[model samples]
Target: MLLALAVVPAVVQEAVLVGIGFHGARGLAPQVTAVWPYDSYHDLRWLLIYHNSWWHFLFGLVALAVFRGLLSAGLTALAWPGQVPRPSFAWLLRRNLEVAALALVVISPWAALSVAFSAVALSLYLFASLIPMLVLAPFLQRAGVARTWWRGLPTIELLGWSVLNFAVLTIAGAVISSTSGWWGVLVAALAGVANGLLWRQTVTAAVLPARIRLARVPVAPVAIILTMAAAVAAQPILNLVTGPPQEWMPLVVTERLPDRVPHAVIVIAGHDSHWSGRQPADPRVERFSYQGLDRQGRPLPYRHTATHRSLDSSSVLLRAQVEALHRRTGRPVALIGSSEGAMVARTYLEKGPKPSPVEAVLLFSPLIQPGRAYYPPPGYSGWGVATGWELRGLFWLVGLGRADRSRPDEPFVRSVLVNAPFYRNRTLCPVAGVRMIAFLPTVSAAEAPPGEYSRIPVFQLPAFHGGLIGRRAAEERVVDFLAGGHVDQPRREYALLQRLGAAWQAPPLALVLNPVWAAEREADPAFTGRICEPR
Candidate 1:
């Protein structure tokens, strides 16, 4: 009921806003739910939250507060009990509000990024994972719930329960979005209650915590842990037996635009997208963002193929394309690579023939320098990296040592493993006129050394797993950069929502994780926040 009090009001407000945004589209629930948290944030951010109309903007501000601030305070209030003669309601409300506010200092950065991802799943996880520090900031609370970390139960929680909770609630939100009218209201309420129960059980460990306490010998914990372990280990084994669906999207070039443009963009795609990839045969400016850039550099088409004999071979193909494009156009070329494709782009730039004709490069989610993935507990970052390591061990343990990464690895892990690293770091040689930048997600790793990205702007977006390309904000900035517009990355975040605990354009993860990003390492002279287009 308390959780409902927190979740339902905002949800209702969101429903109205969705209705308004839908602009009389039929099936409010279906329209709202069709794209989900991705489109949810996009519409809210662009159309509503930052709408041109004054009243719409004001309403968006209030709605944002109701959605985030209220939820935080409510979660804090709920988790705040268990202390002696629990404080009075008035005092409880005030004090918990204070705690939620302080936690906001921490949450804002992450929240901004979550909004950036456009996926509520990550946002929910961000809140669930960290709010436990605030005792019931909604979803899983580690300090209170997972008391069996010493006995290796935390591994299960981190690898299993937390993921489950994040995924389920995300789906639940979608379910709620899918209902409307009076019947839909009831359905939404019921869905809200169901989610509340799950959140309560997860946040408080209602079911397992009690059993854990009663069974002093960890019998319950062990049994539960083993079951979860088997479940986790089972899926991959099944996949190994029954390989994943692989439907590769081939590059189709039918001469839609002039091929001899001034700047040709070449994109090197990451691992199997289920393998979805599309290359604009004859784009006006050679890439998505460079459509208007008749003079600026253009990136190569994003390329993905399972047929590459090796990473080196992939880079060779990139060089061949780069040379071929430059020869035809007699113009400079830019390289845009994502995931393993980013590594392939990096290799060509670093080791290709000297006096490199490639004048600009944009690496999306590259793995040029992945930090140590497997460290001890409180392992803050590197879940993506950790998964790769875990998979290697799991496959080896299951007697599949030779399992090819082509099928075995997730995109994140494969990126890290692809450019494993040299005995030592390579010296960077950044060109004076050339514009080189990397659009990074939440994870650390500069993708290049201090000097390599010394001049160009390195964007820290809220995207991951090849999601940067999908974000509107990222696309806008990328278009500007590709078009040769001077990029001015933001140094500090827009502070309008500091009091309300809102996060804007800055990377929320950098506040604690990446000091390099937080410091805005080596931004150019033309740096400007994308919060608004200030003349």
Candidate 2:
């Protein structure tokens, strides 16, 4: 009864949200009922990701009630077969009816909403079967019931009812999810139903009910595979119908140096969602410099920072822009790329239509080794993993799987691979052939191999995510790299750097090839130099 009570309101709420609330958002004409803005709003994504797990608990409770009711009624009828145990029968029937009714309530507005709600409801019901009988002692006992069965009946009914209600709510929730529009409601429902069936359990007891012991169900590996396939396929299709997100881009330029100079620099933005959020206020972007000229014919320090949204796909576009700028400005250009942007610069050098006027390249903490290590793998469970269990649950809810996973084992021998282009495939960059001066953080002897570090000159920085580069002396070293001269003589920590730079006039393909403080050694050949040392 308690579960039923919960279900009834949830179903009603879901129905109202889906049927009336959603249409109002679209300004559609009035139907049998109309909802205000707030009434129509639903958080279906939350329902899909979070509520499904909750429903698992709730459904376990309901399933327990159903199985228990069947047993109690059976035992009583056999003991005294003349009477129908009308009270118990009525309660069981009402619980089922209430849940079913709630499902309908949520489904009335949209089928997809119903499916999502139903899946969550079913998952919850199944999960509830795990709860111990002792925990439900209070709910089992109700007013006007002398027998122990009556005590458990209401709570069981309530559990069942709650499942039904949540199902309805799920439907409504799916309808209102930002990922779903009116059409997605319908598509998602079918997907949700199919996805939900994958985890269906026959037993109803927290301790494993005896009722379903004799039953047989189909289980084929092919079916499981197909279910996985269907779930994966449904999500992108639903998202497409709902709406493709609009990509955003923001650009900021800072030129605070002498004016009217002919100096120039070209920058290729990195590939990460975090890249877009970087702005002038950020010290990282602020400290990062581009070569530009002042009015007095001296080199000017300038910075053009790309917002995070633009960082994802702007690299190839920026490479082309650099070509255009080169034609227009006729200035010597230096190229700076961070992370994935380093790859973009390289690609532009190799494959872009126009010749790159950029003289040099600088890479910071590049994700050069692609494949599984590129991004942290999704966690097996919810917490502690980079991508948690909730996201996996979401994929299940939306009928999605690993179709979008990337393959990085392929060779990079050719400029253009036959199978996929990085720009079209990864949706990042299309440019190729740029040389790079790569700097990576400290790596273990076991992790570093000749193949990974062979051709490229490597500068090992301290800490994760390039902590060494953030140092002021390191920044000056970078400034010197741009200035086209290496550190000259022997010094304390930079003795190796000075020797390498002074011995070799041509810049190495990789930065930090000589040593981390090589440029500083060139700046001060004497033993007294202490610019790079911490005070």
Q: Which candidate is the best by lDDT?
A: 1
| lDDT comparing candidate 1 with the true structure | 0.39
Q: State which candidate has the highest TM-score.
A: 1
lDDT string, candidate 1, 29-117, tens digits: 22121111221222233322123234554565455433434443354346443532333455534543443333333333223322222
What does the lDDT read for residue 242 in candidate 2? 52
Q: What is the lDDT of residue 22 in candidate 2?
A: 34
Question: Residue-wise lDDT of candidate 2 within 1-535, one digit each (tens)?
Answer: 2222212333343344345333212111110011101111121111222222344534543553343334333322222222223346566444433333332222112222222222211111112211211222212212112222221223343344324323433333323332223443443343333222211210121112223221233222233344334433544664587564321121212322223322355544442212222334311122221232334322233322222222223445555455555665676555656544555555555455555566656665554222111111232221112112323444455543444321211122111111112211121212234334555544211112111122334455444443434555545544555556452221232222222111001101111122322332221101111112221
lDDT of each: 0.39, 0.30
Where model 2 places Cα greater than 4 Å from the true spot, the runs are 1-263, 273-315, 372-435, 443-450, 486-535
